[model samples]
Every structure is written in C-alpha cells, then in structure tokens.
Target chain A: MTRRATWRRRISRMLLRCLPQLMPADKVDWATAMTREFDYIADDSAALAWTCGCVLTATKMRIIAMVASFTNTPHKNAITSVAVLVVTALAVTLMVVAPRTLTPAGGGMAEGGHVAFWLMYFWPVIMLISYAATTRRGHCLPSGFLLLSLICLYVMQIGTALAVGPAMDALFHAFGANVQAWDTTLKLALLVPPLLTVLQWLALNRLDRTLTVRSMRNDSFAA
Target chain B: MTRQRKASAQTVTVLVELANNSGQWLHGYAISTATGLKSGTLYPVLMRLKESGYLESRWEASPPAGRPPRHLYRITAAGLRYLAATDDDQVSTSAATR
Candidate 1:
C-alpha cells in the first residue's frame, strides 16, 4: 500500500475505533451514514482531521455528561441503585487488587481484572446494540433503557480513562519505562465521551413522550 | 395532526432548501452542503424532521458504482403545510400602520 493509504488506514483504525461505543444505540444509523461519507471524501487530510476531531470531541463530552447525570438524576429505584453500587465496588476492588496481589496466582486474579475491564468495555456496546435493535423494532421502552445505560457508560469510560492513562503513564515513567508507546492508545480510549452526549440529550427529551403515551394507554385500558 | 412548533434556524434552513427544490429528492450530503450544516448536526436534524413527519427519506435506487447508496430526503405534505402556515401567520402579523 502507498504511504498515505497506510497512514489513513491506521488513522481510521486507531481513532474511529471507539466510535461504535461512543455512538448511542439509536444513532447507529448515522454510524453507517458517516462511514460512507468519510470514505467518499476526496481529501485525505480533511478526513484525517474529521476523524481526529471526532475522537477528541467524544472524549471531552463523556466527562461532562457523567457529572451531570450523577448530579441531576441519581436513580429510578433504590434496589437498582444499590445493586449498581455493589457491582461497582466489587469491580474496582478486582481491578486494583487483582493484578498486583495475585499475579503470582496467575489466571484467577488476572481473569478477574479482565472481567472488570470488559464490563466497562462491553457495557456501552451492549446498550448501543439494544438501542439500535429497539429503535428498529419500534420499541420505545427499551430505547430509553439503552439511552440511559449509554450515558452511564460514557461517564464510566471518561472516569476510567482519566484514572487510567495519566496515572499509569506517570507511574510507569517514574520507573524509567517508555510511556510514549501508549500515547496513541491512551488518546483513542480517552476521546470517547462526547458523541453520545448529544444523542443522549436528544433521546432523554423524547423518551418521556413515548413513556407518557405508553402509560396513558395502560390507564385507558384499566378504566 | 398537531401543528408543529416554529422551526429553529437550522430546521428552517433545511426546510427552505428542500422547499426551494420541492419534489426533488436531495441526498443528505447534498442537503448538508446546501444548508452549510455539518453532517453531524445535519443528520440529527434530518432524522428528527423525518421522525416528526416533516420529511420523508428513501434510499437511492442506483448509486454511483464506488459509493454506497445515499438516503434521499424531501419535505412531506405536512411539512409544506407547516411552512405555509408559518408564512401566513407572518403575513397577517405584518402591518405598515403599526
């Protein structure tokens, strides 16, 4: 392959990687739409710039959204709230203690850390899939569920990246380790929060309308 | 059907563009270029308008060989009615005496 094509391939692979997760479930249609547009663009430089901008924007958005969601709307129910807290506590403990404390033990702790890692990884993926499916099927109830879950994932990712990249980079560099190798990966992971917030905000507003209509139908039937 | 709310500037831009070439099936990218809205903003606005019954969209019958089929959007009857109603309201409210 030519040098420009190689670099463009790398740019597409590295930067737009987390786009699937950053994109809300319902907006997955736009994902397909954008991929085509990106491909159809004549200028490689413009495409690279757009891809990089998307990554940067997505990451910044998630941090702000997580804070807002936490401050404004905590939970719909006590049980789910408590359940989330317990699972989160368990995951954090596994992620922190599992690798260092039990590396000698090997599989179990390492695998536990992996599980914790994938929870945040697959969390948004699952919500996004749920949204795309439901929106296609004309199911609004699960669409709302997917929307809320995605916003949470955006927040979770922003928190994880903020905690992971810089802290780990500093820790490794202090030991004279080369942290430069991780800069690209760190950037891609860090830049995931923004895209979904716009979609999440749109969904959040319209979600109530669907819910109200469903509830009204139930009320009429009861009467 | 409920009368749609007043169009935002972005929405109006899209509408004006579509109404200017009414009945012509303009692709999303073409509309984006015409309206000067970024694809990011334009797609969401288009999707909302489509969902709100102000627009209709369909995939192109035959796309250029290399590119994927484009989605063509046009204003629906309800959409034009909304534009006309807003225009009528504007005309009635105008006054040289005032």
Candidate 2:
C-alpha cells in the first residue's frame, strides 16, 4: 500500500476506536454498528468518510443526551443554588485569606503571586454572574454551573498553591528537611487541579445521571 | 404516547424506504445509502421512529466471520399505519392544489 493510503487507514482505525467513547452509554450498540459498517467499505476515502460521519453523529448524540439528562427540576435548582452560594463564599474567603497569608507584612505580593491572587479573586465572581444570567434566561442547571464550579476549583487551587507551598517549605525546614518552594507550588497549581477537575466533572455527571433516573422513576409512578 | 407531529421530507423518504422492505430487517448503513441521508441524519430519525413505536430494531443474530454484528431495523405495524396516513395527507393536499 502507498504511504498515504497507509496513513489514511491508520487514522480511520484510530477514529473508529474513539467512536464508542464519544457515544452515550445507551448508544453503544449503534456505535458498534457504525464501526462494523466501516469494515464493509472497499475504498479508503469512503471508509474515512464513513468514520467521520459516525464520529459526528456520536458527538451530536452525546451532547443531546447530556442536555436531555439535565432537564430542570426543583431539586436540581435548589442544589445548584446552594452550590453557587458555597462557591461564592469560598471565593470571597480566598480573596480575603490569600493576601494576608501570602504577602510579607511590610510589603506586597510578588508579581506572579499578585496575578494569581487577583485571578483567584475575580474569575469565580464573573462566572457566578454569567451562571445567574444563563439561569435567569430559563435553562435547567445550565452547563454554566459546571463551568463556574471548574473556575472556582482552579481559584481554590491557586489559593492553595500560594498559601500552602511556603507553609510546607517552612515546616520542612524546621524539621531540617529541604524542599523547593517553586516546585511545590508548580505541582500544586498545575498538576493537581486538572486531575481534580476531571474527577469533579465525572462526579457531576454521575450525580446528574442519578437525579435524572430518580426523577424519571418518580414521573413514571405519578403517571 | 407519541405526539403527532409533521414528518419532514427526509423523514418521509426514510419511512417509504423502510416500508418498502416491511418484513426485512435493514441495518443503518444500508438505509442511509438508499435514502441519501448521512449517518448523522439517519440515526436520529431511526431513534425517533423506534421511540414512537413506528419501528423496531435488534442486533443481528449471526454475522460473517471477522465482522461485529450490526443493529437491524424493521418497520412495525404502526409504522405502516403512519406511512399510510402520510401518503393520504400528501394525496389530499395535492388534490386541493390541483
């Protein structure tokens, strides 16, 4: 086979592997069907076209499923409101605490710390306002809530990196153990938050699925 | 209960294709090829039809070696009724226009 043909085949194989992950759980059978159909096309370009179409279809289906799962309920609304309030309070607390804890008594924060502090302070408030606007326009626990939560999570992460790294270094020094402050801060700030964010997103999806299932069961009983 | 909504032109085309092969179970790719609909368009229509009891589907029981089984769809009795109703609607509208 030509190198170009070989590359097309490899790309199509890779995309086909991702097709099922792109689909919602219930649509796995359809994803399988589409993947199997790809084996029947003789022409490489046609196979690639088929794979792209299936990928687009799966993505569209997944988005629709997510939106449908988040249909508005009073319970969801209450939970979301409480969540927003808690995040806002956390942001406020961080805004107040980080500056005091991180800055030297007679001087200001370092330039990077200063930028991180302001970002940790303001981004959540802005996201909260955006979430409010979206909900006011009548959406069911808008994806904005997720975005807000993620932003708050990053802000908290920044605050932790600023506040904890120096504190840890000092403790380690007191124990005659050496640790680099920048290394600790960089790890705390960069690596941990993304991992936590992915967990948070997964947890949110599980929660939403549970709520949707419960509400559906209640609705069926009502009917 | 399925709501009675107007079927779009593409929907009608799909229905007609499936109705023509009433007893035979056709998989998605074949239906897409025949109806000139992309996979993106075809699957949603199939989902709606199945949800509305106008169609039924199952995974193929047996398949050729080295190939995974595909999901096969067939028109239900209610699908035939829907197609008949749609044809009648078109006929009356055309008659009125003439």
Candidate 3:
C-alpha cells in the first residue's frame, strides 16, 4: 500500500478501537459488527467515512443512555446532588475570602481566628477523605459506622462555627464596629460550614442508596 | 390498550427495506447501501427495532480468513405486522385526503 493509503488504514483502525468505548456496554456487539464490516470496504475514503458514521452512532447511543439513566434517578436525589455542589462552591469561596475580611487591620487574625482558618483550609481534604472512605467501604462498612462518621464531621463543623463566631464578634466589638448588625451576620456566616457538612452527608447517603439499588437490579437481571 | 404511534419516514423506509428481504439475513453495510441510509442513521434505527422486538440479529457463524465475523439482521413476524399496519394507515389517510 502507498504511504497515504497506509496512513488512512491506520487511522481507521484507531477509530474502530474507540467505537466500543463510545458505545454503551450492552450495545458493544454493534461496535464489533462495525469493525468487522470495515475490512470489506476497498475504498479508503469510504471506509473512513463509514468508520466516522459508526463513531457518531455510538456517541448518540451513549448520550441517549446517559439521559435515560439520569431521568431514572429520583428527583430528590438529583436535587440534593445539585444543591451540595452549589453550596460547596459557595463555602469554598467564603473560606478563602472570610479570613481577609475577619483579620483586624495591621494586626493578626482575631483571637481563635486561626482555629477557624485552619478548619476551613482543611475542610475540603477532610470531605475528600470522608467520601473516599465511604464509597470504597460502602459494601464492607456497617451502616452505623457511616452514620457515626457523618455525625462526627457535623459536630466538628458546628463546634468551629460556635467557637469562631463569638471570637470574631468580640474582635469587631473591640474595634467599635456596629455590633448590632455584625453580630447576626457573623453567626450566620459561621453556620455555612456546618450547613455544608450536613448537605455533604445527605448527598453521600443518596449516592450510596442509588448505587446499591443499581447493583441489586443488575444482579437480579444476571440471575 | 397500547396505542401504536406512527413511525417516522426514515423508520418506515428502514422497515420496508428489511421486510422486503424477509427470511434473508442482511448485514449493516448492505442495508446501508441498499436503503441509501447513512450508518449513523441506520444503526440507531436497527437498534430501536431490535429493542422493540421487531428485529433480530446474530453474529456470522463463519467469516473469511483474516477477518472478524460481521453482524447480521432479519425482520421478525412482529415487524411484518407493524409494516402492514403502517401501510393501512397510510392508505386510509391518503383516501381521506382525496
């Protein structure tokens, strides 16, 4: 084969390899069929066009399958997942910006501010570890242990809020800032972490349930 | 009672092609060429027909040396019934317009 023809053949083979991955698992047989049929097309350009069409078909099927699965999911579970993501974004923003706002001008952070700062800093890491542990051990760990872990995370968040809110309130009072409006704002702002932690727990629980149900359905179908 | 929806023009074209070759297993490429349907459109239609129990498919029992087996498709009895019903619907609609 000439170099150009050989290049076209190699590209077609590479795309054929990707066809199965683009298709849904149950429809893999169609990908295999398309690959085998490619050998019969003598014209290189036609073969390439056919291969591209197969890839498009596989992609369209995969997207349809995904949308169907998403629709199958409970609306409450979907809503909770979206809410968790949005709240987590807000919390991270607050964590990054709050320290600057809370620190007294030309001085260090308010008393006990470091406690809140470090807790907020490490909060994402803590949540990551929690998520990894829960999902990885989802089958092995007792439900009680999972609940206990979530409760502990929640308590830590609430403790941080209670501790840091008062200290920031006191610091603002000493600076003779209007305590009347600032006091309520400080308390509410501090509650975000704990609220986020609760949402995380709910989201995790919903995910776990959805996974368990899916596996059970698959098992039943297999049997 | 399950209400049957009207098939799209493309779907009707595919069904007619398959039904015309009843009892003969057709491969994807041949069907694409014969019906003048592109692979992207043809495969999904075939999949939907299979899912709806109007078509059946299988791997070729034996393939040429140095080549993998191709998939083959055939229309089912249900598919013929569906095609006939569609033809009747078209005939009645055309008569009504006249």
Top model number, lDDT? 3
Which scores higher on DockQ, 1 or 2?
2
Per-residue lDDT of model 2, residues B4-94, tens digit only: 7888666777787888898999988889788777777777788789888999999889988887788899999999898888866664443
In model 2 chain A, the worst 10-residue window by lDDT is A169-178
Q: Score residue A49 of candidate 1 by CA lDDT.
A: 58
lDDT of predicted model 2: 0.66
Q: lDDT score of model 3?
A: 0.71
- Tens digits of per-residue lDDT, candidate 2, A39-108, equal 8777788678778888888999989886665554456554664455445444444344444445554577
Superior by TM-score: candidate 1 or candidate 3 = 3
Best by TM-score: 3
Clash pairs, model 2 backbone: none
Model 1: residues >4 Å from true position, as ranges? A1-17, A45-74, A87-223, B1-4, B87-98
lDDT (10s digit) by residue, model 3, range A76-174: 555554554445545543454445446776788866567768887687688767766756534312344444454566466656655566654554554
Over the stretch A1-223, how does candidate 1's per-residue lDDT look in tens digits? 4798768867865666676455443444545555555655666666665565555444444455445545655355333443433343333433343233322322353323344455555754655474555454343433445445545654564465344434443434423443553453344334432333344445533553355445656777999
Model 3 spans with C-alpha error above 4 angstroms: A89-223, B88-98
Task: Using TM-score as the measure, name the better of candidate 1 and candidate 2.
Answer: 2
Report clashes for each candidate as comma-separated counts. Answer: 5, 0, 0
Query: What is the per-candidate TM-score for chain B?
Result: 0.79, 0.85, 0.84
**Candidate ordering by TM-score (highest first):** 3, 2, 1
- In terms of DockQ, the best-performing candidate is 3
* DockQ scores for all predicted structures: 0.18, 0.49, 0.66
lDDT of each: 0.55, 0.66, 0.71
